[model samples]
Target: MVEAQAPLKHGGWITFPFFIATMAGLTLAAGGWNNNVIVYLIEEFNIKNIEAAQIANIINGCVNLFPVVAAIFADSFLGSFGVIVISSSLSLLGITLLTLTAMLDPLKPPSCETGSSFCQNPSKPQLFVLYTSLALASLGAAGTRFTLATMGADQFNNSTHQGIFFNWHFFTFYAATLVSVVGIIYVESNVSWGLGFGLCVLANLVGLVVFVLGKRYYRLLKPQGSPYTALARVVVAAFRKRKELQSSNSQDYYDETQKGQRNIVGTTPSNKFKFLNRAALVTEGDTNLDGTIKRPWNLCTLQQVEDLKALIKISPLWSTGILLCTPIAIQISLIVLQALAMDRHLGSHFQIPAGSMIVFVMITTSIALAIIDRFLIPMWQKLFGRSPTPLQRIGLGHILTVSSMAISALVESRRLDSARSHKLYGNSAVPMSALWLVPQLVLVGAAEAFHFPGQVSLYYQEFPKSLKSTAAAMVAVFIGIAFYLGTAVVDLFRKTTGWLPNGINDGRMDNVYWVLTVIGIVNFGYYLICACLYKYQNVEKAELNDTNSG
Candidate 1:
């Protein structure tokens, strides 16, 4: 009798469709509620406009911030797939609760009359439920967002395939977000809030189901021991051996491969961060006879030492991202306010929803990303004989971001002029077209098309293999911090300058944009200095050398 053949393993291209569908559904679900939250709080919950904006910013920050913790959990304990399932379930529950709140009368306060002076605040229980729902949803969304990227990238082995996957991932993500901003926000504003949130609930369930269905076809990676521990060991060992003399001899360092563990070969310790090399020095009693570390915290491998050094080298570049993103974060919240104050009419029949204005940024970013990936990169490669590096892409983004702020300042000045000319400056909508806000939004979107992916790619390439998920999450963490910082900046302006009062119409909104413009230019100078001093840790040195030569 012939031997039975084992079943073929699943994964690779077989999982792409499932991952795309899941991503689209999740994006739609998250965006549907988040995009309209400020309006929801203002109109339904009877919250003040500025208060609602502040709440929305905080929520956005939480949604981005919690992902770093989720990434840690995935890397340290449960793998990405496990974390995703739990997180998606949490999201579904949150959306369900949110939808119920919309449908039920007791969950919200009585509807406020249009332009009413005294609106009833929500009861404490109602507020508690609302906050709880938001917390769960934000945490859930954050957990799945970037972890999914790491998971999808793991399904493929080829770098080119991984690159293509990321492009499609972002494309699907933005497209679904566009749908939520336009379609769901329109439903919530024009139709019924209940129906709109119900759609989000449905989307969440669908995304979760789709992801579960693809489990068998997924290349599920198990969690390696936490890389943070190794990093901590390096720091501890270095500090402990601070007084010890450094050695240039290779044999003086601990090599774990003698005991059958993998090791970094053919790379010498660099001169930079010379003190860290002490961590790997093989002093007496640092290692056992079997080549295992006697005390892991007292001695680390050369690879661990090098890994810490890489992170240290990239930290300055990492810090620049916070400043880089703060302006964009502030602009995102403020643009909605701007739209609310402008005439949002298209032609004679239809009026645009103020919350839906962000779709312009999403749409532009999607288109620009496609053009850059398909046309610009190839052309640059042909002309320069080397692909554009992340630093170059990020530098272009800085330029574009600065330009966008200047355009924003100019446009706000024009809108202020329109407001003043019509004598409707105090808390009332201006006759100026909302289309005036389009140029700045488009420019910012183009900047994102360059910098966002560049940052992700940069982190993925430079980070150690064990911290792959964490690397993907670094961008989210940056944006999260930026959002919080942006909130602080806005509060500062409100307290100090009158640039951003409760109603932006009566304030010097243009001045705020100009301030951001100056900040962007200064930040760009700082970024350039960091970029110049930085050497590639994981990338080919030849790329930069060749660029310089050309």
Candidate 2:
């Protein structure tokens, strides 16, 4: 009996290399196309600068958003490994199509030379193929990125190991993105778009092959039906029993499947969301003779009730991320436009790719992650006598984000001055160096190093066991929403103010940065409030002591 109950040792540090390699390959493939897509549209598809930014924003929104749906599917039906395999194949197919478009002249719009007055738009058939390719690639990238995070973390039993994995996971992701943005974007810009996209196809294939090779060593979890369904039942059951008196006795609640399983000590259904207790109250006809629920919609288990409450409690904190990401997303898109309008020369022979300016953020983030993991955390523990919590790290992220926005405003102000002084307008490059954008980018990267892994750690640790996949994808969800919101904000600015004109040299881009700074400041205050009010639902005391110890 003891041997039968003993756990199988299927996953450990042994799976680490495969997961890291898989992440590096897939992230490089995704970044290769995604990073340079705006430029691709403008150069190949004859899209206007502002219009291309909007499309890029929308594409980015979709790429991040689809992960949530993929996570749900992984949690509900297909497991993470299966979803990743399918998504990787889809990515390969999509990138291959993208490569063909770059290679076949007929598939592309007529080339519009620099300073040309006239440009031709892509045909309807061309647009259809382009959109289809983008959709598939976005969906494929979405499914693998966050789902892989969850699956990789699942291989570990210790919280410390899991935390370390998340740190290195994001490090690998950013480092791969840096490589793609620099190397692949250079190939697309200086060499051939066909060759660049062809490389993405190869990367995707390699990632898929490497992941499949580690199948036997993975800690595979089967789908235990949809956890979302259980959450919905909790809400419905609570609504149905709204008028019922809440019970104080722990035994009055129906603890189905696992007896005495309480989220809070000495409280079966946590007191914070007391009204939800009625959902698990053992009322008449709520259960059968065998103690199973008769009608799930009318009566849920105590664990289910607690799960819903946990989500509700964390929602405000989750929402803070939306605003945190919004300004960053908008800035990222606008920086490309800024880079295009500024001097991009490095020495004399080499000119930096406008689209690759964001790679500084990736480079800084990768370096920061390594430094934070190896030196910062250990020093912090020794000095503070304890490791920093996720909320503390997130608070620091907010502060740095606000600072970055301020810096962006100042830099944009200088760039606009230089542009106006030189009388540079209508897509002409300003005399000022594009390197002025580096400080803000560096700060933003540092902010991400703090918040991204912190949020991943918090969500994974706090979320219910059944919703682990969804938890891993929650950061992606907020980032997607932020990108969408960023699009709306930019659109609003375009319509209401002359601040973000097509040619920013003819507009007040500094004003846009100032507005984002204000938004960041306001959002930071809200995040502080949310962080203070929230309590961890699933974090164990032992885990706190062991955090980042690995």
Candidate 3:
């Protein structure tokens, strides 16, 4: 008789602490450089304010965008553990280089005297080194960010445990980031850039080492082949069979094998995207006697067709997310510029770090996430007799986002009034307090608390099992796109209007916020339309089946 496989003792709660510690370290390391990069470029490299902002947006976009590629690599070839190890090493190297650049005067441009008419920009070699370091660091961060979440979730068997794991994952992520923004950024701004970057390098090394130490505890999964290939096949087959009529008979379609048996649950393809069902319509020569697919590109399984359908169904909802993030992206990049022009002093002792101002968003999101997960969700379930759906959560986020933009517009209007009254227009610093920017940041954070996790949950649950990692990184894809789009928007405004002039005090930033607010409102309406039309592909069925099974 064959021996039964032994259960893993090292996974579950045993591995949780290690994962948390590693994530904390990596978070601190990545956040340190990422948050303060614009400041570094402006102060050290003597780049223009708007130019630095654009570069920062592009860097943020790359950091978020590259995760999709990393996720695909992990899912299709390397698996999460291998990707994390490789990525962590890259991050360490990048941070070390950054530290060296800060410490060595030759690596940076000559420091410009305060109020100097001329400033020396970094040389070609310096720019090349800086870009290379950023590329390595971004690539490293991309690999670890969401893959670690997937790996941690894999340790749990059920959705409840997985949900709890995600909660802790995000909480730890935001908390660590908050610390970096507050502590490391403070050090960078006040003490020394080299010291701050040195800390990041140390954190990256520690995180990698801690992760390595926990290898025995990890439930290492071998990668299956690329899900994208299968998805692509479905689309190709559907197009090839476009002339063929789809059949109503279950026997006419190929049903995928599940647990050594044919899938009984999805015998009939979903009707939402009826056209894609043609891919699964089995012709006489399409299958072997054993029901194995003969010409894979010409015919696909019902599950494959359904997977494509699910993606198609969710595409409209996903598209809405891009617009939702674009305004937020624009706001985030510009806010730093706003902080630069405003009075950042809290008391006689300390002035707030410009990059650290983003901590308000992170802090608010973290707190809101905890409250929503622990208290709000329970209360919502109690009152409604069910948990709030991801769609509902995302819808609420849309509302908050619009509200935040409006509040931002109002705040900018007030700040402008103060600047004009004080005759500080075209001046470097306005007398208006930087704290006025907090409310909008907090509001945006609250919106993110609602939508970011909601998007992840929605995609994770709805996407094909093979594409889980891809689903997790889908939010990153749109956020990346939004950042790029935001850059274009900023560029457009710079060329076309005076709304985004280098000096915020001289420009009509309030108008830009108003424009974003208008865009948000329109996008929210589109989102509502999409959400209303969308039928939960797996959630309702999974819940109902669970109830029935119980």
**lDDT digits (tens) for residues 255-370 of candidate 1:** 56755442435245778899999998878897667667888999988878888888998888989999899899888888887887889999997889889988888888889988
Candidate 2, residues 76-184: lDDT per residue as tens digits? 7887888999998888888888888899998888887743468788899998888888878988998897889888988888999998998799878877898999999
- Superior candidate under lDDT, 1 versus 2: 2
Model 1: lDDT equals 0.85
- Clash pairs, candidate 1, are none
lDDT of each: 0.85, 0.85, 0.85
lDDT score at residue 538, model 2, on the 0-100 scale? 70
Q: Write down the TM-score of every candidate.
A: 0.92, 0.90, 0.91
| lDDT minimum window of 10 residues, candidate 2 | 1-10
TM-score of candidate 1 to 2 decimals: 0.92
Runs in model 1 deviating more than 4 A are 1-8, 157-161, 258-268, 546-550
* Residue range with the least summed lDDT across 10 consecutive positions in model 3: 541-550
